[model samples]
Target: MAPYQFIERPTPFNSKGGSTLPIFAVTPAHIETGTIDPIALDWAKKAGYKAESGSLLLIPTEEGHLGGALFGLGTNPSEQPYITGKLARTLPAGDWHIETAPLTANRLSLGFGLGSYRFDRYKSEKSSAPTLMIPRDADGADIKRQLAGVFLARDLINTPTNDMGPNELEAAFRGLAAHYKAEINVVSGDDLRQNFPLVHTVGRASADAPRLLELRWGKKGHRKITLVGKGVCFDTGGLDIKPASSMLLMKKDMGGAANVMGLALMIMDAKLKVDLRVIIPVVENSISANAFRPGDIYRSRKGLTVQIDNTDAEGRLILADALAYADEDAPDLLIDMATLTGAARVALGPDLPPFFTDDVELAQDLTEASLETDDPLWRLPLYGGYEKDIRAKFADITNAPAGGMAGAITAALFLKRFVSNTTSWAHFDIYGWAPSERPHSPGGGEAQAIRALYHHIRQSVR
Candidate 1:
């Protein structure tokens, strides 16, 4: 499938022929200080343009031709850093350049590119996007690389389960690995049963066999950064089953995998001097006569028996095995992203996912990066008091705890049990779906936390 059409890097702006339109990112203060053109300022007073956040006004020349535009930054531009995203959808299709802004060029350009994304792979008609001449001060390649990663993730998650099943998802994974020239391997069928028993169990009932997909890149002796993602392609909630409304968006169950792929792309594209590894447990949680039951106990890859208290909780099951495998390597940094629980959304909502980590420095770095990248994330405590909730009476542990209190934390603790070897490890419980349209992001399968992770990882390694 073709990639999403994003903002372009245009030739350097020259005012000789008036070919390009200038866009001023103005705050309320700028408007009051008469910082804008006198003609545009006079028009603004007549038109009642207060320069509110995300508001746009087109400036016309004396000849009645489109001359320029003003994008409002409001009084507190920092409060809405990516407010320029509105321009991507509101601007007329034309060559434009940012003449002035309160924020960095990278921030404005990335926001525009992000808002320009459209998943029209299945549409009959294509949409046209306005072009932006990347600012001279911006890192054009960096912006493009991040945009590609985000778009790749959104595309994968937005695909319907019929076209995004285990097989198709693996193909996409392989395609990415091939593009980056990374070594790839898969363990499936009977092999998966022995190597990743929990993964095989969760994915066994689907028509497509479940598998463990692994990719390795960069030199072996460098700072090792291993990523694990939950890849339940289409979750029917297994034998437990979900209400029709709940299952409608289950196709995004594999959003965790999509996000990790995005982060991996950014890491490889920048050629960060660090050893990178990705482990994804790809599966479709379906129901059948032979489907793993709520009472069934299966041995995990870590040799721990897990009782299926609720088959609906399958993401953490597959992630348990993958995390164990990743932990065995004892990478310098181990990170796992999963759309594992609705409780995460309950706690922090879909926009700000909660992450759990024991490492103080990792938490601080991720917090700083989250703010810097505008990829919001909140750190939740791995409370030891809740450890008893995951304990099983008949087995080593239970996949789902009763009462449903602090569900997200318990799920993280369950996965944390298998990650004993890794010193710096963090788990993100992401909703992965945007409930409604927001500035710079459309409502669909969304990329959460990866940008922050990418920023933190890149800075730490460098």
Candidate 2:
């Protein structure tokens, strides 16, 4: 069977296929105005569907067929931008179209498409999902491009570590470079030790081998945008092993790398006018005698000596090298994404990622973009006073702060030390996976903050 297709061909105004199911997005105030068809209104009233927030009421035809679905948007429709996304899963399987709604047709269409995503790579039987017909006035191209980037991230993160190790990530990285004619390079194995010693130290024990992947694109004179992602394909906590429960979701440790590439796809696809560079310290933090031990000291690519207070803190070590590499160029913007700390998740919960930046203008732009794009981010203070938290007694910095108080802030400070040249640098500590299903996001690997960053860049470049 053909895979689910999201964008449909342009149709006449208010056009819907015969098999297409209508979805009515209504608010409580609108419902009381006697606007809905009497039959649907009667069925809805009897079913206790008061059009409250997040409520769903299925309408039946006179012949008892699946006539349509009524989705509640509460008092304010904008507050429930993603409410219609639920329709992709809840309503019976068929083509779906929006009959009435306050949201832009494009946003609603994108929400529906995002909800249609399912990871069936290892499944024996794949279930069919309800498909959405792209609305006539909607920017189908933009929606498809964004959805493609998002699905790329979701697929990469959802794959088990067995199939998504460093080597496979390199292949995917290379594939993206080849698609856009980007300059790509990879330094792996012992070669990594010569320059990126920290990256090599953390990944040496894995069978797939450790590597630094680089991709550069766009014209040289354009504004330079550099992205560094922690590509710990599967983090097993190294010698300092995590408990079985903690290690269960290690496959998504590479979510930062996945998201970086996903955003790269959007930048290239949209032909955004900027020079882009993506650096990923792709590695697996696996256990073996060769694994870097806790308390070991290693020199980073940036020439700072680091002491591994805990082997589980390997992501920061690799990112230190990559961010240092990115900082050397002193691009217009430097952003690094990582699944850095559990403290971040505990502080902000799963939905909102915490970003650290001293540049006020950059922070303002990101805040506006986050609001505009619906990709939420919260700013966490760099707290220069906490600089001592990451200090190493014998080395330049400690990978793991001993007290673990303000772990997230200390981790951000640890990364900040490597970034001296770049003035507009921000670090995003993301959960990378949704703890549970949301209206527009599935349970597995979810892309965070990239859309907002993309919007910021798009505006900056123009």
Candidate 3:
């Protein structure tokens, strides 16, 4: 929560509002046609501004008063949808408007608000960025709601493991449920072991007991939608352990839970006509005397025995139970998201997450939504050939395969075994953390696929 403010139906220039500036986004074409303001043109020439990407210039009148400013869009302005986000940090702490551009007011304002985000929760002091006063035509409220969800996810993800353990994660989940007036049920510790053995096995070592968190909202008879998230709050790799470098960002192991919370926020805020259920198995994969060993075998909630070939692959174990639970009711749509495998990151890198789903229509809708929202997702085949890879002689299945080939696919295949009843179920292997900065996103905890998924849901609801 910075000093930024979004005003609806903005008023024109007036003496009452001090130091308000007008921003004109310019492309190479605009420069060639002599369409820009004469004052700004003169300033650009004097300042050697080429209207290249990220270029900004302010014009001064004869009386030394601020005239207007120019922003560069390079070859295609639409490509950099959130380029205007820079205006919030670049311009002085005051009101500014996009005078002309190929972009919509909603996009411009949304970018500004998103760019202004800072996870200074632990910081001593926070800086005040310039406020972006949006136009009346812009969908300010909707954008605000979406960003709120993203920020909520980011805040939860960024918190260190010490403070964001299983109990704290349940608190965050409960907070969201309370805000939306949803009913919440939590089965924790020993009860989890009895009902969700896979979830309990993965989290048995941690002092913060493992919990199966469920929140339900909307009418019972409405189109049913169930969301399952892998809430590994902090993964220390259990008995197998991890290298120091690999453990650094393990706080984001619960990214799947964070993302689901974000998507749930978007759904509940919009009052979408659907019964929504969120299932998160909040746990921390820590090491101790009680930690589940890699070779340990345990019976899962779905009545299938699992041999833990790798304790590091515990995310899928917890999700297996949650997914099985979700499948029992056979909802209209079921989605499970998790930072399940580094193989996914190796294949698609950090920004482009991979999703697995058998439904052709669902995949097509999600693909279009990805393009529409600029939240990219690649469809990876759930090859039945790899199904044998997860099969184990000792148990019904193994959490990890022996060959270590096609890890993402094998993980998806393993999860697929538990989801027999759901008509439409998709699995998302998300990085959950942005490796670097983007136009609208900072480099911390990133909300992946939710925007695109929201678009897909919107279409489905309509």
lDDT of 3 at 111: 78
Comparing candidate 2 with candidate 3, which one achieves the higher TM-score?
Answer: 3
Q: After superposition, how far is residue 246 of candidate 1 from its true place, in Å?
A: 0.2
Q: For residues 14-51, write the lDDT of model 2, one tens digit per residue.
A: 23556588778888876788687677778887887788
Error of 2 at 219 (Å): 1.0
Q: On a 0 to 100 scale, what is the lDDT of residue 243 in model 1?
A: 89
**Best model number under lDDT:** 1
Local distance difference test, each candidate = 0.88, 0.86, 0.84
* Candidate 1 segments whose C-alpha is farther than 4 A from its true place: 1-18
Report how far off residue 406 is in candidate 3 (Å).
1.1
Candidate 3: where are CA atoms >4 Å away?
Answer: 1-19, 61-67
Q: Estimate the overall C-alpha local distance difference test score of candidate 3.
A: 0.84
Model 1 C-alpha lDDT per residue in residues 356-445, reported as the tens digit of each score: 999999999999999989899999999999999999999999999999999999999999999999999999999888988777887798
TM-score of 2: 0.94
Alpha-carbon RMSD to native, per candidate: 2.7, 3.3, 3.7
Error of 3 at 30 (Å): 1.7
Backbone steric clashes in candidate 3, count: 0
Clashing residue pairs, candidate 1?
none
Q: What TM-score would each prediction reach against the true structure?
A: 0.95, 0.94, 0.94
